[model samples]
Target chain A: MGSKEITYQQIYEENYPKVMRLCMGYTVGNESLAKDLAQETFIKVWQNLEGFRNESGLSTWIYRICVNTCLAEIRRERKKDKNLQIDNLQVSDSVDNATEKEDMLVQLYKCINKLSSTNKAIILLELEGLPQLEISEIMGIKHEAIRTRIHRIKQQLTKCVHNE
Target chain B: MNNFEDLQNKWQNQTTISATEDGFQSLLKSVKFIEQKQRTGNIVLTITIVILVAFLLYVSGYKSATFMLGIGLMICSLVVRIAVELYSLKKLRTINFSKESNTFRSDLTSYYSFRKYTHYVVTPLAVGIYTVGFIILLPLFKATLSNGFYTYIQCSSVVFLMVFSVFLYKQAKSELLKLKQLQLED
Candidate 1:
């Protein structure tokens, strides 16, 4: 594949996992919804590829689209009273057979979904190892606010995961 | 109780879902479909507006008061509807997709509400003019067709306008409701 032709394919291949992971967090492990949202996000990226000015890094641009796409899907789900976040989730607290690590992983996602959408994007980016400055840039917020928000969101996630 | 550190560790370790080869192809096809669909809609609307403007120019010379009035109302309604759609499209085009989540949320809400206003007010006006605009052509239709055919044409035109208006109204309402729910949750 020529560079011109495979450019979009290359980006999709590289970012698909991270995009789906962000959607997974946003949708609270509603796997099908995550996939659907991921699909939509990539479609948008493909459509708008020509318009990208490189003002923001490609990853940041794609992440922003991912967040917006997930938020849009979540909103549509809410209108249908779809219980997309906490309720329909197959979140299991029982570690009876699964490892303790496995059980906590599910709980962590549950807690992540408990957060507001912006926080979900923030913490997901943080967990994915994006710098706070980059997260702030992608989120259109002050760097300081992102730092404070990350602290607060972590506290909230901690509480939710522990059922405190 | 998992602390923030523990949660972060688990989150990072969680499995990532990769798109299957077939899944990627399907997604690419969907992107093509969506682009085609959007382009089709825009082209049809543009063509309709162009045809209406051209026809209005052709009809303007006749100087019948009712025909002129009907033409005027239709041109007004078409312009408003197109302007609203253009404005919505412009807002969407300029959206900094990499901006703040809150900004995206608010902008989406704003677009839907503006569209709702246009659909709510302009659709009815468009329907009214559609009926009147067709009726204005009754004289021309009568010159070529029987009275029964003219009556048939008028009734069908009105019915089509009503159906079209209702479709627009329902679509706008559904869009607005989705945005409201999104903002409500935020």
Candidate 2:
């Protein structure tokens, strides 16, 4: 294999779980959809590998691509069918039985889905344990603004999850 | 789950889905396929545009006023259509997928709105002029060609226009739907 292919393979292996976790948060815990989004994000990364300028951390670049991909999917789904959101909220077909933890995860996702699309991206990044500054970078908001938004989102998710 | 800290802890503890070797291999193959597909599409579009321009130049030598007028209108319309398509493609390339969410959304909104304008106003105008141009040339074709060939030209033009109209309508509908999607609530 060429050096580029070897490097790309390493990057893909390292980041797949992170990308999948973020995608799951975006897809309302739909594992299949999350997988698809993650796959799409990696496809883009591979395509644009030649243009990677190293201006930002590699993770930051990958997360940005993943976020953009998820946002596009959300827009497409919003226009295509309203019911898909509800369908995604149901236990995914791939999961035969839902554990209590899985149920809570779904409940959390349901709450996250209630936020505005921008907020959804923000909290998903936050949930992935990205620094507030990094979230600000991915979101293109001021760090102060991201911090405040994260606080609000956290409280909102807590209330929504408790209600569920 | 109630406490934010506990939620974070659980999120961190969730088992990571390991990448399968087979999946990675397939992904590499698909990436190669996508690259080839995009390259092919660009080449085909470029070749089509070149052929259309060359055909227009060839017909310009006929020197009849009506022929020139008809061909001129057709070429102008084709130019407008091609310009819009090329501009759209350029705009899409300008959007940086690595940018922050809000900026990316703004860029996409700009791109979609441009498409919405093209679909609603520019495309119909171009198609109408092109159709009229073709019709204007029909009498010339009838005067110059065999009766059988003239009839064949007329029949094929009508079929082509019908098919093109349907394609345009579908494209406009899809663009409108995508524009609606971009209206994200704050």
Candidate 3:
């Protein structure tokens, strides 16, 4: 394959899984919506690829685009479904386990749904094991702020999960 | 038992999902289509404006100075449009897609704010200037509005502009509030 083709394939392979997970978080793990949003994110990344200089890591750039795309989708959906409350959406916290995990995951997603869109983006990226500096660069915030937000997000998540 | 580590552990092992090929393909096609439409629409709009302005100048028989000033304003608008497009391209280049940080959110907020301000504020200001220029040229063409009609049009336009401006301001405020809420949630 040519270099451009190789790069495209690599990007698809490396980022597709994680991007889908991020989309899952934004959609509160709704399978269809997650899939749709993930696809949208990738499409945006592909279209904007020419603008992608090496100022930040390729992954970070992709994540930023994904987050924005997800948020924009959320906003568009909100306009269509005015009665839908972000806070009321159930979050799935299930991991590995089937029966009990489903309930736990649902509760977890509910708390996540309550978070402001940006917070959701931050937590999703952090959960995916992205570094703090990279997150800051993607977010266009100071490194210190990303640190503080991560710390606070953890605290909030703890409180939320406990209440559930 | 409700510790951060426990929650983090569960989240780490969460099920992975993948997007469908159909959706991805469609989105890519849609984006290309939209870009093409916007470019074509802008070109058509520019041509239409040029034709209209030329016709208005011919009818008004305005002094060369006034005609030149109107042309200058149109050129300035075109330049501003190009500059805005370049800035947006630069921003799109700088965006990071993999990392989520507070700064990224803030930068996105700033970028949107700048866009809204230019569209709402600068657009109206340009319209107002053009309106004044139109009024100046109207007299040159012996097409003056009656005194009462002129006053009414001016008052109505002012009121309409004020209402529109207030609406835009409220929308901006709400968007800012949403951004703040997102920040606070973190």
Q: What TM value does the first chain of each candidate achieve?
A: 0.84, 0.86, 0.83
**Model 2, A1-164: lDDT tens per residue?**
89989998999999998998888777766677778888889898987889999888899999999999898776655533223343333333245443555566666767887788888888888888899988888888999988888999899888888887
Cα displacement (angstroms), candidate 1, residue B92, comes to: 1.8
Q: Residue A87 deviation, candidate 3, in Å?
A: 14
Instruction: Assign candidate 2 its CAPRI class.
Output: medium
Order of candidates by lDDT, top first?
Answer: 2, 1, 3
DockQ, in order, for the candidates? 0.49, 0.50, 0.37
| CAPRI-style grade of the A/B interface in model 1 | acceptable
RMSD of 2: 3.6
Better of 1 and 2 by DockQ: 2
Docking class of 3: acceptable
**Predicted candidate 3 versus true structure: per-residue lDDT over A1-164, tens digit per residue:** 55754465568767887887787778776666777787777766766777788777787788888887886566545433323223423324443445455556666677887787777878877877788887777676788988999999989987988886
Q: How many backbone clashes does candidate 3 have?
A: 25
Off by over 4 Å in 3: A1-6, A30-37, A51-57, A68-97, A116-118, A131-152, B1-16, B60-103, B112-186
Taking the tens digit of each residue's C-alpha lDDT, what string does model 1 give over A122-161? Answer: 9999988898998998888899989999999888878887
The candidate scoring highest on TM-score is 2
Point out the higher-scoring one by lDDT: 1 or 2.
2
